[model samples]
Target: MSAYPTDRQPTHTPVMLSEVLALLNVRRGGVYIDATVGLGGHAAAILEASAPDGRLLGLDADAQALAAARRRLEPFGERCRLEQAWLDHCAAAAARHGFSAVDGVLCDLGVSSLQLDDPQRGFSFQQDGPLDMRLGDAAEQTAADVVNYYEEADLADVIYRLGEERRSRRIARAIVERRPLETTGELAQIVQSAVGRGPRRRIHPATHVFRALRLEVNRELERLSGFLASARGLLAAGGRLVAIAFHSLEDRIVKRFIRAAGSGDDAGFRSLSKKVIRPSADEIQRNPRARSARLRAAEAV
Candidate 1:
């Protein structure tokens, strides 16, 4: 396990925290789940807001994150339960922890700062590290595998579909020509060289490519689909399910899931907000990472 300094706290400021609490309607003594509880930021807040006896089950794929969460939430004593697990396993974890029919479920999807800031984890191209982007320790494949082993055509498809990059073909060709790439910096350089620097580019040219590799390595979309399919069944009647998604792809899934769930008379949920909720300007100023967050919520019928 990665050891973090006890004196220093996790730098990740939970995105749209107030909105998440409001959407989940966290109440005293309520049972809740933070399905992607990285560093226990949101879980800590939930426990505090819920006060006295509110119980929480916090699950995360990364053991390092769970360790940080453990230290951060220790003050809550038995009020918070931390588990090292992926989003897809949330239902089983909830049931085992005696939290079935939970009052609310919050899924904060996509990469957390803890993963990105750790250069050794390779979630970002900005900081050089080994090409290992597995969100959890057990992933069979790594970013290195995707870049070095995938056929040019297959690589292009992954970048295009997951990263939504229009120049995926060129990027993939460049990467194949560079073969056996071993580090995040090497891959980022190849992508930047292929795509070239554009005028007034708001972000790095290699940003999307890195995101695509991380997503593929982690099977993030597949896990998210599984979580969405099962999360509603874990909620009690009138219970809420809130999801905060960072990118368009993730936001689209949450939007569609909520819409589909509320479409039919027999559907298990009803939409709580017709429009997506976003962080306030002040919050974005405080934490720039909050800029892309979009929250969608629904209540179980």
Candidate 2:
């Protein structure tokens, strides 16, 4: 329970605690993997519960997130391992350190609080910052580049299909007319102006657009598909895979993946959590970010 303040505060709060702990089925001497180890909140809890000889291999694409996780987990000493890598190839990365048959794998599918809080990362529409949205240190396509270079139709499709914005076309037109969006504040303002600034809703209008951009920048969905496939191959018999998804789309993917993994004859896994587990109202009140989290789990056959 050590929380250190850095230049950028981590905004991610690990959700669905009790459910994930139960689903993990941690055992002494077992090996575990926190496939999306962001700031070590869930990883810390897992390390404590699976104490003594149980080892945890935590992986994250964000180096800053990994550094935060390492700091939060420093007390664990040799019992924990932190690796900087995309979750899609984390299984291979895990094996590199001699964890070939892990007992459990946990992936929290939402962007970490750190990613959102760090203004320069550009995951938030609330804060003014640069338009960089890379998950890892990879210097690939950024939100800034996309906003400046993508055609009107492409931007509209990104906002419409990924963000589910009803006014995507108008927003896209507004964005295109603006010519260049150099910062998060500029982009958010354009969106607000197009939508005609109304009373603050439950969420900001630009929230989904930022999500869409981040997902595109990081190739989130494609990586998730690869991770699910690799995770099945990495787990041993009776091993469990616990996932916490923050949105409907992610939950749907997890639901479908678990179902496919549990099918007979050629099944890769068995259902551990038949239904998704949501955070308690108390948890949500304590950490508003937990309100949308959903946890699901499966066991390797």
Candidate 3:
């Protein structure tokens, strides 16, 4: 059922595919960039819609994801160019690939299903694995380093500021009490014990803690801010910029950046949607991960 090769194909679906393509206004011969092209699902669709002449430059932080993307996008031959790099370097990568000004730029922010499903990557607490949560090999620190080395106050601050966890102090105290935490399972158990697991709870007790560590480990927020600043320059006049953010922190950044870019005398963009776009109920049912996706679009002025 997948367009990718049968061997080692990633199982993730592209979230809000229709909306992204529509908002991008993809057309034949148009050049585009997928700033976080995880697994190439959206890239493939964009390539297909663009038909014979459309060219795409796909960038990703994970080498493994880039490998999968390379295989999936190989059918398009020279029409697609992929680079293993973080979102923040999209403009540089685009320039290197001769895509200085593109018709559209898509940034599907946050961890992809490929990273979360792989226990070794340690983005989730559902399975036991190393505490490393770096999105790519370029990152210096891992979740283990943050959990085991940071002081209680610093840890609590990170959790509270990034994860917006109300019980960050309690959670940080618990983590400090159990120092030198090595695995995801160990960390998850400690947090659950500290937070008190209840049958009525909607999500795991350690969800925010894990999210915080991953974000901190990867410096995702900082990189996202940098990328947004460069995105306006990367787009040609009338070009579209489509961003899909998974959590409030990321969504809030995108919302404010677009709002500011669309106003004032130096106005560079015009927001395409008055309201944030969310996945349809059917999409959420098909892929539960789609439920949290928030899509925002703007056109370069």
Candidate 4:
């Protein structure tokens, strides 16, 4: 297990925290689940709001994150259970921890601040680190493996399809020419050179490519889709299922899933929000990362 420092607290700020608490409707004696409880920001709040006898199950794929969460939530005693598991295994983990039927389930999807802020994790472009971007230890392949070994055509396809980059072909060609890349800084420089570092660019030139590799390395979309298919099974009647997605790809999946699940007369679930929820200007100022977050909610019928 990765050792997290206890001298100082983690700097993770839970996105739309108030909104999540409201949507979950946490109450005393109720049970809840944080499907991606990074650093236990949301989990701690959930436990506090559902005070007295409420219980929570926190699941995460990253061992380092779980360690941090365990420390942060230790004050809650046995009211919360932390597990090192992915979103897809939430149901099984919940069941194992006596949370078979929960009052709420929250999935905060995509890469987290915990991963991005750590230079050694290689999830950021700002810092130079190894090209490894595996969110979970179980993942055998890393971003290095993908960029160093994938065929140009396949790499282009991954960047185009997953990253939604229009110049994926050009980027892939550049990457192919620079094989055996071992560090994030090296890859970022190559991409910037190939794509041109124009002043007009709103975001970094390598943003799309890095996001593509992270998604592919973690298989986030595939696992999210599978988790959503059976998510309702873990909820009790009227229990809310809330998701916070950081990117367009993840937001689209959540939007479509809730829409489809809530349709028809005999639907098992109903959409709680007709429109997507976003952070306030104050929130954006405090934590710039919350600017891209989109929240969608549904309730089991």
Per residue, candidate 2 scores C-alpha lDDT tens digits across 1-301 of 1223666545456788777878888777778999999989888888888888789999999888898888889999999999998979887898797887788999998677777776777778888888888888773788888888998999999988778788899999999999778889999999888887667676777888888888778888778888998988888998999988888877888899999889979998998777788889899899988888888889998
Residue 85 displacement (Å), model 4? 0.4
Residue 41 displacement (Å), model 1: 1.1
Looking at model 2, which ten-residue stretch has the lowest summed lDDT? 1-10
Worst 10 residues of 3 by lDDT: 1-10
Q: lDDT by residue for model 4 over 27-117, one digit each (tens)?
A: 9988999999998999999999999888999999999888889989999999999999989988888878888768999999876777887
Candidate ranking under TM-score, highest first, comes to 4, 1, 3, 2
TM-scores vs. true structure, each candidate: 0.97, 0.93, 0.97, 0.97
Off by over 4 Å in 4: 1-6
Clashes of 3: 0
Off by over 4 Å in 2: 1-12, 197-201
CA lDDT for candidate 4:
0.91
Q: Give all candidate RMSDs, comma-separated.
A: 1.2, 2.9, 2.9, 1.2
Candidate 3 residues 118-194, lDDT tens each?
78888889999889988788999999999999989999999999889999999999999989899999999999999
lDDT, candidates in the order shown:
0.90, 0.84, 0.92, 0.91
**Of the candidates shown, which would achieve the greatest lDDT relative to the real structure?**
3
